[model samples]
Target: MASDPWQGHDAAVLFTVLLTGVPTVVGLAVYLGSRLTRQARRRTTPFRTWRDVSLAAAGAALALYLWGLLHVLFLDGQEQAEECERQRPEGTPALVGRRGDFIPLRLVCEASDGRDYTVVIPGYINPSLTVLLLLALLGGVVSLLLHHKQRTSTRKKG
Candidate 1:
């Protein structure tokens, strides 16, 4: 067990919002903006199916999601280090590097009150959901590409 400056449940919620909600909103904006640009270029409205609508949205959402996950998993150490620096109680010796080959970036510190603490700071996402989201994104992209090809070939033939 690692000491978290944030409450566990609160951390989970913050991670969800940071990793999912913000990106989803931004993705939606980009998706709609691209659609509008395509429509303007073609001078016509493009057909959209329920599946296409859902899948495209899903793809955008998932792509942004994976980016956020990567940041949390691999690029958030600096933020955590900053947190440890800002939050550690005063006069605690400089945080020592974690031992072992598999340890996450962390600081082992002893407080002035003589209590030992392991400040294991890291961002998190659910692995299972990440896998599922990736698969769905792949499927969505394949389906969309096939759909576009079919439409273009039909337009050429007609």
Candidate 2:
């Protein structure tokens, strides 16, 4: 048996708050600041194009997904650790397993009131989320470039 894995719960909670809450607050501040600055300038900016809106929406969606992912990876991680601890037998290690990159491996751990756990760590990243994040980034960049080009052409025409 291994030592208690739930000892790091406090640190994980702090890390989760820093990772998720800080960025969300910062993003909101930036957005509100930009809006206030634009309003103060008293410039009647033209409405954004549908494509531009769509790209921004995609970016927002990606950000939301990332927020959820962080929560799941961090907050849920702590919960899982606690659950494992609760199910663990007294005076036994929280984890007991082989330490090697070999097949036919076995891990002895308690989770969710179960006596055993099959921890399968995937070798590859999640392709779907990766693709979606990349697509959001690309769309945002393209939208910026097109908006700049449009502004330049409009200025030239005017």
Candidate 3:
């Protein structure tokens, strides 16, 4: 029987949870807070659209990150080990061990013959998350600049 790679690594699991969970929670909170505020005010500002788009992008990225984390932590290792065992050359013996990666999340299965089979968290996920994060940052900066400009212009007139 294959042992659980994550078993007995309480610190690592806790760290992973905190690293991903905090951002996810913050992103969702910001998104929901803005939505609720907009509903309460019942008026849209010039920068509101940009701000909302930024928050949406952040939320999407965070969701993807969490999904990838879930796959890495709970699903991939054992399945990939089984696949490796099946795919190994005949008479090569069983899978010997497995290893995991956190960033870009993946599992590597080691066979008795010293071959390694890697199962990667879908190719598009990390890159897509990165792009979304960049979009979110750019949109946030644009929104802030526009908001600041609007405030300054009003101040000058007043």
Location of the lowest summed lDDT over 10 successive residues in candidate 2: 98-107
Q: Which candidate gets the maximum lDDT versus the true structure? A: 3
RMSD of each: 11.6, 9.9, 5.5
Q: For model 1, how does the per-residue alpha-carbon lDDT over 1-158 read when each residue is reduced to its tens digit?
A: 25543222234543665667666756666765665575554753233443345555565545554444444344244554555567777666665432111123223343435554544433342343455456556666666776788789999999
**Ranked candidates (TM-score, high to low):** 3, 2, 1
Superposition error at 35 for model 3 (Å): 2.1
Candidate 1: clashing pairs of residues: none
| Model 2, global lDDT | 0.46
lDDT of 2 at 93: 47
**Where does candidate 1 stray beyond 4 Å?**
1-20, 23-124
User: In angstroms, how far off is 152's CA in candidate 1?
Assistant: 3.0
Model 1, CA-based lDDT:
0.49
Model 3 weakest lDDT span, ten residues long: 1-10
Local distance difference test, each candidate: 0.49, 0.46, 0.69
lDDT of 3 by residue, 50-74 (tens): 8887888888887777666665555
Residue 104 in candidate 2, Cα distance off native in Å: 25
